[model samples]
Target chain A: MVVATNSFPGSNGTTFSPNDILDLEKGDPLVFGAYWKKMSEVCTVVIKGWELMSYLSDAKNVCWFMLSEFGDAVRRLHHLVGNAVIQERYIVVGTGATQLSQAAIYALSSHSEAPQPINVVAAAPYYSEYPSEINVLRSKLYQWAGDAALYKKNEPYIEVVTSPNNPDGVIRQPVVKSEADGKLVYDLAYYWPHYTPITHQADHDIMIFTFSKCTGHAGSRIGWAIVKDIEVAKKMTWYVHMSSIGVSKESQTRAAKIIGVICDGYQNIGSIESELFFEYSKRILRERWEKLRKVIEQTKVLTAAKYPTFYCNFTNESSESYPGFLWLKCDESIEDCTSYLMEKLKIRARAGQRFGVGPKYARLSTIGTEDEFNELLERLSNAD
Target chain B: MVVATNSFPGSNGTTFSPNDILDLEKGDPLVFGAYWKKMSEVCTVVIKGWELMSYLSDAKNVCWFMLSEFGDAVRRLHHLVGNAVIQERYIVVGTGATQLSQAAIYALSSHSEAPQPINVVAAAPYYSEYPSEINVLRSKLYQWAGDAALYKKNEPYIEVVTSPNNPDGVIRQPVVKSEADGKLVYDLAYYWPHYTPITHQADHDIMIFTFSKCTGHAGSRIGWAIVKDIEVAKKMTWYVHMSSIGVSKESQTRAAKIIGVICDGYQNIGSIESELFFEYSKRILRERWEKLRKVIEQTKVLTAAKYPTFYCNFTNESSESYPGFLWLKCDESIEDCTSYLMEKLKIRARAGQRFGVGPKYARLSTIGTEDEFNELLERLSNAD
Candidate 1:
C-alpha cells in the first residue's frame, strides 16, 4: 500500500533529513493556504444544516446519533456495491489505506501458530513503501519478524504481494508454477470502482483500497480491506482492533452514514464532487501513463508492455519493467540514467534496488496531479 | 492516556455490535446536519472567525502544525501545565487518547534486551478498560503475554495505574512503594485545567490525557502523551508510527492549530459550556460518590480508606474503595450489590471481579450528565 516516504527506515535516525519522497516539497497538500481554501467546500458538505440556537432547547434528538446523523448515511454505502455479498465477511474499514496495508501485514504475520516469523513478498519494482511497511512490522512496537530481503528457504510462512502493484501499476497474475501453494498477501491499494480489475482469485489473499484516489478524501484517511477467507478476515479485524485502538470512530461513523445514504440509492451517485474526484484522479493517471508510454516508445530504449499497464522487462543493456513507474535501467558506463536525469531535470524517482529489484533499475511514480505530471514529463523529456 | 472506548479492547462493545465496529463504521469527521449542528461553537475559540463557511477552510488547518500557524497564541498555553511541551522530546500526538494508550502498551511490551514478562500493576478500581488494553497488547497483532486474569514475566511491561480513575472518581496516589528505579505508568486522563490545577507539577511518571474530558472534543479523537524518560518517549513515538499509520495526521494537525485559541489565557475557562461539562461530570460523580459514601457511612458496611483520590481500598468488609466508584462487597447473605442494582434498577455497573479485584466487591460508575446522575442516585438510594 502507499506508505509515505516520511515513514522511511532511517527517518528516526539522527542524520535523517527530508527529501522529495519524505517531504511533500512544493506540494500544495502541505500549503495550508490552498488546503484551507479547499477545506471550505469539504466543510460545507461536512456540517451543513447546523443551527446554534436549537441546542438551547430541550430536545431528545440532541444526542450525537440522531435521524440525521452522518453515520446513518455511511452505513448505506454497502448497497452501492451491489456485488458485495456478506458485507462483514468481505470488508474491514481502516483509518486510511496506509493503516489497512499495515493491518494486512499484521494479520498475515500473526496467523501463524506459536507466533512464528512470516515473510513479506512483493514483486519487483514494487511500492517504495513496502519495505518500510516491513520495517514497521518488525518494529519493536508491533513485534512481528518482518524480514524484507527475501523468502528464506524451508520456512513455512505467509507472504505479502501486490497486484495492479505500486509504481508500475501492472496487474500481476502469479506464475502458477512458481507459486504452487505459497500464501500471497496481495496489496490492491489502488483498485477501486473504476481502476483495473484484479485477477488473482486465490482464496489466501487480502486486498486493500483507499479513498485518497478512489474518492477525494485524501485528508479523510478512509480505507478498506477485502478478504475472501473468513479466518483471515477475523485475524485482520482483530489486528485492526489491537493496532489502531480502532479506526477513527468519528471518521468511520460518518463514512458509514454517508455511504449508507449513497448505497440506499437515495442520493445521486453522479454528484458533481464525486464525479470530479473520480475524473480528476483517473484523468491525471491516464495522461501520465500515456506520456510515459510515448517516451519509452520514441526512445526505443525500453520495450513498452501496454498502455494502461506499462511494464516492459529490459534486457542485458537494461533490466526491470517500466510500468506505472518508468523503471529505467541506468548503466554504470552511461553515468547512470537515473542520477543523470535527476541532476539535469530536478526530478525525483525511486531507485529499484530499494524494492529488491537490484541496482540497475530506477522507478518514477505518478503521485503528482495533472499539472505536476505535465511538468515532470517536460522536464524529463528535455533532460539529455 | 484517556483511550476512548472506540479502540480495540476499547472498541465500544458496550453498545454497538462487533459488526458495527468493523464494516459499518465511518472514516470521516462529522460535518453536516445534526452531527455538525451547533457543534462548531464548541471550538469557537480554537476555530475563530465564527462564520459557518470558515469550518471548511478551518478543517484544512487541522493538518497543519498549530505552533507554526498560531505560534503567539500557543505560547500562552505554555505557562499552564498541561502536556503542551510540543517537541520531539517531551510531546507526541495521537489520533485520540485511546491511540496513545494502545501505543504506550506496545512500546512497553515490545522493546527491551532482557524484556521481562509483563505485568500491569494497576491500582484497584481503575478504568475498567485497563484489562482490555492488556487484552489488545496480548492479542496476536501486538503479541504480548497477559490476560485480565493472568500475566507473563518475560514481556516488557505496562501498568496502567490511573490517577482520578474511571467508575471511581477518587484521586489516588500510589500507596505501594515505587519501583527501585522509580518507573511508574500514570494515567492522569482527567487531571486537567478543568479538574486539577494546571500549574501543579505533574509527578515524574508516564502520563496520558484526552480532549474528551478537558477540551470537549470527544468525537474528534485527539490526545497526547507525556513521558518523563526520553528513551521511553522515543519508543512510544515508534509505536505510534506503527499504529493507525501515524494518528490520522489530520486530527493531530487540527489539534495543533486549534488548541491555542481554546486554551487562550484559560480566561474563559469559566465559560458556560466548560462549567456545564465540569459541573455535569463532577456533580454526577459527586452524587454517585455521596450516595455510596452515605451508604458506607450509614451501614458501616465498608472500612475503605477515605482519601481525595479516585480510589480507596476497602480494608474491612469490601476489598476496594467506594470513592469514584461504589465498590460494594456483598456476600451470599448480602445481595451481590452490582447484580442486585442492575436487576432491580435496570441499570448496569461493572462487576469488580472484572478488574482483577475479585468477587464480593461490585463497581458502579457515575455516568452521564447531572440529570442522569440524579436518576442514578435515586436508583442506588432506593436499592435497600
Candidate 2:
C-alpha cells in the first residue's frame, strides 16, 4: 500500500519551515499535476533561441508524417542522458506516453497469429490506468489479464515492466517469468534522473518515454518509444498515424525547441551554476523528499519506503531517493488511507485499490509546486 | 470513381514563371502535399491574439481533463457556420477528426452485448481509410464488413457516411437501408461553407469536424465531434482519455484562439472587406476550381466533376464549385488515372482504388499554394 502526498501548507501555527516566496509564487495553481514553476525557470534561461521561430513556419515540419525534428530531439536527449539505447532503434512518436502505451499493446498483439486474445499483464500496484486503457478497446488482439504476479498461464503474453513504478516508486521486473513466447514492454516514464538514479542504460526490446515527466511540459502531450524491432516500430507508427494522422506539428516543433534547449544545457554543463535541467530538478526533488520524510517521521501516521543509494553514471555520484510520486503506507489502524487523508487532513490522494492493492495505501504526487508540497507536509504534521 | 486535383500552373519557356522569385524563395518544392502556404496566410491574420500566451502559463487549461475552451470554440464555429447542430449536443475534442472517427467507431461498437462482432460498413468509393483503420485494431467488438451499398446482412451494423466524400466531392448519406439496428457516423470533415454550400444544418447522431480542412491548421491536429447521445459522448471521451490523455493542451488552446478569431470575424462581418475566413477561403477555392476547369477543358485529357450551385444561407449568396479536393477522371484511353497523371504529366495523385473505386479515377488536393496549383496547370497544359 502506498500514499502519495502533494500539499500546500497553511501559514499560521505550523511546525514546518516556510517555503521560499519565489518558489511559492512560481508554483502557479493553474497548472495542476505539472511542474511548470521549475519548467518556466529553465524556459526563461533559454528564451533567446531565434531559430525556434523557424519551426513555426516550416511546412516540412508539418508534413513530418513518419519522423520529425522532435523525434530526433528525443533520441538526442536519450543519448545524452544515457537512459535508453537509440542506435538501430526505430522511434515512434505519440500524443503522450499514454497513447504510446496502447500503441505498443496493439503492435505487440495485433499481428500475432494466435487464434485467441493474448493476455496483457502488469505487476500489482501497477499504474492504475493500464487495465482500463487496454480493455477499453475490446480488441480481439489482447485483453487485460489481471496481475502478473498471480498469472499462471504459459501461453503467449505481454508483461509491462514500469520501472520506478507509478504508485510505489520501486524498481520492478516482470513477475510472471514466462519464457515461452512472452514479450516485455518497459514503461520508463519515471526513469529520468530527477525521479531515480540512472543506474544502467536500458536496452529493452520496447521502451516508452514521455516529455511530460522529463521536462514538465505535460501540456505539449509529446511522447516517444524506442523499439528494437523494425516491424513493431512500423506498426506503432501506423497506429499513431491512424489515431491522429500524426502528433501535433505545433507541439512537436515546440518540443523540439525545448528538448534542444535541454540538450544544449547538458552539453555546456560546466559554465552554468545550475549545471543542467536534471541537476536543478534533482536538487528540488531531493529537498522535497527530505522535508516530507521529516514531517512523516514525526507523524508516524504514514511511512514511505526507504530506498538505497545508487551510483548515477551521469552525475557520477551516489544518489538517494528522488521519485516522482511518494508511495505512503498507512498505519494498520487506518482502514481507508485515501478517505482518511481526505477527511482528516483535506488531502486528496489515489487509493491503493485502484492500483490493485488494499485500502491502506494511497499515492500522492510529490512533483507539484513548492507551496503544494509544503502544505502537504504541514497537513501531515498537524494531522496527528 | 473520384479524382481530387490540387495543381498549379508553371511559368514560361524557362520551366519557371515569376514563381522563382517567390516559390524558390518560399521553399515551395519541399512542401508539395501540405497546405502550409495557404495556412500561413490565414495564420498571419490572427497572429496577435495575446490570450494565446496565457495558455502557455495557465495550467488550468492544461489539466482540463473534461471539456475545454477549444471544444466550446468548436461548438461556436459549428453554430456560426450552420454545419452541425451544437445545442444539446456533447462536444468531444480529439487530436484530429481522425482520432474522433476511431473514437466514434469504438463507442458505437464496444458497449454492445451482441454475441458476434458488429459489422462496420461504408459506401464503396468511400474514404479509403475506413476499412484499414477499423480492421487494423482487429477488435472483436467491430470488424470491416465491406461496402454498405452491397451489404445484405440483417444483423446489427454501423454505417459510415463521409459527406463531401474524400476522393469524391459529393455529399453522401448512409447507403445501408436497415433502419432497425443500423447506426450512422457522419464524417462531415469537408462540409464547411468554404468547401461546400451550407445547404442545411447537419443534425446527425454523431458528426465529426476537423480544423485541418476548415482553418487549414493541419499542424495543430485539433478536431471535434458533436455526439447526440450522452452515453456515446462519455464513452468517446473515455477513449480519448485512454488514447492520448485528453489531447494536447497547447494544441487545444491554440485551436480555441484560432477558432475564436474565425467566429469573431464572422460576427463583425461587412465591417472588413476581407469578410470572414470562409469568405476568403471560398473565394480562393472557387478561383482555383475555375482555373483548373479551364485548363482541363482545353486538354480534354481528363474531366472534373461538375457540381451544382447552391444558395448558401450563411453567406446569403449562390455558391459555386469550392471543394477541398478535386475528383478527376481520366479519359477512356487511360486505364490507371493515378499512374497516367504521374507518368505522362509528372503530376502526383491518389488512385481511385484507394477509395475502393476503379483505377480510372484519381484525387488531387486543391488546397496547396498558388504556385503549386499554377505549376500543376502548366504540367497539364504541356502534357497534351
Candidate 3:
C-alpha cells in the first residue's frame, strides 16, 4: 500500500516537472459541476429563446398545477437519451433533484395511523449531501439510517441507489437485499448520455433526473422523477405542493426550451456539428477524464475509479468512464486526502467521510471550465 | 337576516334581467394572477435585456450559494414599497414564499437534544393552505396545531401573521399573545402597494415577501425573508439549501429583472403612465374592488370584509378595502357558502372551513382578469 503524505519535500533536490508547475494561490474549481460556461455558444439560443413574444405573453405555459409542455419536454429528453423508459411513468417536477430525492423518501415511507418512521439508507460512498438532506427536517416519516450496508432492520426501508453515483461514478443497485419489502429510489441525475453509457434503460419504481446534470444548467434548478407507482407519484406531487406550491414555472419553461434544443440537435444530427449539446458535453467530459487520468497516473499519489467498458445504445459505441466526478483514493499514508490536497497543493476536494467512507478518499468535480481543468491537471501532476 | 340559497330559479315567472346577465360558461380567470400579458409591452424590454450577450455569458450570476442581484432587488423593492425596513435584515431566498413560510416554521422549532416539537398556529380565517402545508411534512420539529385562538399551550410555539392574508385579504397581527417566548413570522406576501395601503414600515424579526403577489409573476416563484436574528436566518438558509439546494437561479434572474423594471418605473414616475406595474396593478385592483363591492352589495346574499380607512403613506390618501381576495360571509341560514356559489351559479370559491372558519363564509380571488370579475359580479347580482 502506497502511503499518501501531506508533507512537502524540504530540500530533497527533487526537480519539479515543467508540466507540474501550477499557481497554488488560485483556488481549485473542483467544488461544483456547473459547466454552463463551457457550452455558452451552443446555449446562447436558450437566452435568445426567452425573448420570443410568446414566451412572456402565453399564460397557457404556466398553469399553477403543472405545465404539460414541461412534462412533455421531460418525456422527450428521456426518450432522446434512451436512459429511462418514459412510458407508463408519471413525471413529477421538483425545484431540483435535491427536492425530488426527499420527496421520494417521503413518498416511500409509511404514513399510517401508527406511524412507523421508515429507515432511509444508501450504499457506502454515497452522495455527500444525502444524509443531511434526508435528516434536515428530522421528519417523522423517515430517518437517515446511514449506509445501507449496515442497515440490518427487517422492517420496510428506502434504499437510494444513485446510478453513475455522485462522488464515486459507479453504477449501483440496492445493497440491502432483504426478505422484507424495501422501496428503491434510483437517483439517475447523472444517467445522461454525457456522463455515462446507456447500458440499459432504467425502469425503476422511482427514478429522479435533473436538467442541471444533463445540460450543465445547474442554475435552472429543474428536476423530475419518473415513478411507476401512481400512488407514490401522487404522494411526491403532494409533497412538492406542500413544500413549494409546485416548482418554478419560469425554470420549467427554460428547461423545456433547453430540452427542446437538445432534442432538435439529435434529430438534426448530420446538420449540426458543434451545436449538439450531448455530443459536445460527452466529448468534453471524456477528454477531461482522460487528461486527469494520465496526469494522476504519472504522480501515482492517488488512484481513480476504474469503470468497465460498456456499449452505449444512444451513441452506438463502446464507452469508457466519463463521470462528472473523479473519485480518488489517496495512498494509504494520507490520513485525510481532502486535507492533504488542500493544505499541500491548495486543491479543494470533498472528503470521502462525507460520503460515509474513510478519509483516504476524495472526490473532484470533472465538469468545469477548460482552464480550470488544465489548472487541476497541473496541480495533480505535482502531487508526488 | 337574508339567507344565501343554492336553489336556482325554477320557473317562478321571475324575469331574468338582460342587464344582470353573465357569460358564466365562458370560464373565470380566477385561477392565476400572472399579469405578464398585461405588462408584456414594458416587460418586452426585460426579455430583450437578456440579449445583451453578457446576460447568458455571466456564470457569476448563477452562483451555487446566493445571488447578490436577488438580495439587492429584494431590498430595493421593500424600499420602493415602504412596507418593510430592510437595513438590518438578512435576506434568505426561497422557491416561493410558500417555501419560506415552512422554513420559518422549521427555523423557529427546537433543535435541541430531546427535541420538543413546537406547535405552529395561525389565526382563525387564516391562509387556507397553512394547515395542509404544515402537516404534510409531519415533522418532529413542529406540527400544525390549528387555530391560534384555541391554542392553549404555554410551551414554545410559532404564530404566523399573514398581513393582507391569503383567502381572506385582511391585515393580521399575531393572535396568540402568550407571555411564553413565541416567534412571529410575518407573511407579507400582499403588502405591496397594489394590494394594500402601506400602513407603516413593518419592522419585524421575521418577515416574508414574494415576487408572485407583488409583481404578478407567480410563474417566477421567487420569495424571500427578512430575518433579524442571525441564527434564524442561517437555519432558514440551510433549510432552503437542503429543501431545494437553493431557489432556481433562472427564477432569481427573472425576478431581479422584473423588480428592476418596477423600480425603474417608480424612479421615472412622471414619464410613463401604463408602463408602471404597481400603478397599473393598483388601479386595476382598486377598480375591480369597487365594481365587486357594488354588485355584491346589490345582491344582499353575502357581506364583504369591512376595513377602517387609514391614511396611506405610499399613495398619500385614505384607501378603502382593496384586498386580493374578497372575504364574503354568507347569511346565517347558509351553511356552506362555497357549495352555494358552485351549485347555483357555477362559481367556484375557496371554502371557509379550510381556513379554520365556519362554513358560512367563502373567499373569491379578486385579482383575476376583468372578464372573470365581471362574470362573478353578474352571477352574484342575479342571485336574488
Candidate number with greatest TM-score: 3
In terms of DockQ, which candidate is strongest? 2
Per-model fnat list:
0.15, 0.39, 0.38
Please report, as a value between 0 and 1, the fraction of native contacts recovered by candidate 2: 0.39
Query: What is the C-alpha lDDT profile of model 3 across A1-384, one tens digit per residue?
Result: 111111111112233334342222211222122333333344443321112211122223222345677888888888887789989788888888998998888887746443677888999999888888988878888888889988888888889999888788898878996667788899998897778889888998999998767765565678888988788888888788778877776667666766776677788843445446666668777878888889988976788978999999988888885887778888977888888887777676778898999999888767644444666787887797
Across B1-384, the per-residue lDDT of candidate 1 in tens digits comes to: 111222211112234221221111111111111222233455432221101111112222222212223333333444444333433325545666666776676566555344344455566655655565555424433432223223324333455656566545465665434332223466766664334333344554467766444444444456666666676666676665445444543444344434553454245653424333333333434445566567555543332235433221111111122233444565465445555545555555567666556555666433233333344444544444
For every model in order, the TM-score on chain A comes to 0.65, 0.85, 0.85
B1-384 per-residue lDDT for model 3 (tens digits): 111111111112223334433222211222223344444455442221112111122223222245677788888988887999999778888888889998888888847443677888988888888888888867888888888887777778889988988767777878896776687899998887777888899999999998767765565678898988888888887788789877776677777866776787788843445446666677877887888788878876788977777777887877865877888888876788888877676676778887898889887767554555666777888764
In angstroms, the error of model 1 at B206 is 4.5
Better of 1 and 2 by DockQ: 2
Q: After superposition, how far is residue B283 of candidate 3 from its true place, in Å?
A: 2.0
DockQ for each numbered candidate: 0.19, 0.31, 0.28
